[model samples]
Target: MDFQKRHALIKEWMREAASMILASFQEELTVEVKTHRNDLVTNMDKAIELFLIKKIQQSFPSERIMGEEGFGNQFQDLKGTVWILDPIDGTLNFVKQKRNFAIMLAVYHDGIGQMGYIYDVIEKELYWGMKDQGAFCNEEKLPVVEDVSLKEGLVAINSGMFATNRYHTTEMGLASSGVRMVGSAGIETVHVASGRLAAYLSYSLCPWDIAAGKVIAEEVGLVYKKLNGEAVDLLNNNGIIVATPKAYQEILTEYLLKK
Candidate 1:
């Protein structure tokens, strides 16, 4: 596969998606509840997801797509080239703050992540990575994050988890320098990848929520794993932790695992 060509195409598609999302701010959105009041879906989310899926289908007709908006294929296994997409990662943020949201996409080939992208539309920051080629923020290459311990750096925890003290998350936050809640998994994951945050812990995240971030974060030497210190299953929802190696070890051994 010509990864360079695909990468270029993905960037183009993401930029187009971003433009669509930004333009929607001028218009009233048709927002609806999905699953619950807090869970949301908007016209822009569906539109963007469809737009990206169309682009991928046109370019790579053979690839399968699994999207958050239910516009893509359904599969039980990751046997071939697969695209994972979350058109608008933080819908509530988009609706309320109109910022802090992101568009995330990832590509996996036979269960291995081949490429990942997380685009912060408001900031125009595009974070991407290709397998073995390294990760980048727009044109700038990202370096490995510092191996900071949990107490040495700030962490981001899911608000609900921290508030509820799920898995001793409140204690974990107390152990860290501080705790943050960015709401968007992609944004939080990139923060960890870029050394802006020591770690990100989420009690629940779907495949699309973390897939792109996982690839990019792993490239810069961040550990992506389930809360139990196991590999994340890309086909299912998970409780996730993405952090620098030292932070990961400390969080797992000292906080999460402590009885």
Candidate 2:
């Protein structure tokens, strides 16, 4: 399968996409609301996704692509090699802050994740993982997060979860060292996978939002699951909690599992 070559190829494509996105910041954006006022999409997002899909098609013509920007394939099953991408994650951040957003992509062969890449575009840090090979930030291998309890670690929670108090999210924050809101699932999950944060809980997320992070989380030994403790279903937009093992158990018992 030449998995190493495929990994390198995907990373190269991501770098090119990142360059396109960075160049767009100098010009005015063509932005529109997708689902609501806060749900935004910019021309740069669509352009980057198209660029990436083109690169993938030129390199791996047989693989299917599922992208957040509606510019890729529509598939009913995940039976073969598939590329999942969120071209510009945290679009709001990109529009407003212009720095916290990221570009994420993951490769799944026969329904098993083989590689994941999350590029913090402005930060210039690339978090990538290959199945059985471990995860890395740029060239340095990332260690599994330390086994920390809720009280000892920082937690990241999404705005929806915080607003609704979904699964007692406020209580969960009180239990942890503190709560952080990165506004970007990819960046938040990268923090968890790299031990900078103990966990990230999101009330709603589509496959592209977490797919890349999931691959990296698995490689780093973090647990990825629904807030209710069920396995993550890659096809569904559901509550997600990705964290170090010990913190997972603690948050599940003390916060999510509670009424």
If scored against the real structure, what TM-score would every candidate get? 0.99, 0.98
lDDT of 1 by residue, 1-259 (tens): 8898998899999999999998999999999999888789999999999999999999999889999999999989999899999999999899989999999999999999999999999999999999998999999999988999999999999988998998899888888899989899999999999999999999889999988999999999999999999999987889999998999999999877888
Which candidate number has the best lDDT? 1
> Which candidate leads in TM-score?
1
Provide backbone clash counts, one per model: 0, 0
Lowest-lDDT window of 10 residues in candidate 2? 231-240
Q: After superposition, how far is residue 140 of candidate 2 from its true place, in Å?
A: 0.3
Q: What value of lDDT does candidate 2 attain over all alpha carbons? A: 0.91
Cα-based lDDT at residue 250, candidate 2: 92
RMSD of 1: 0.7
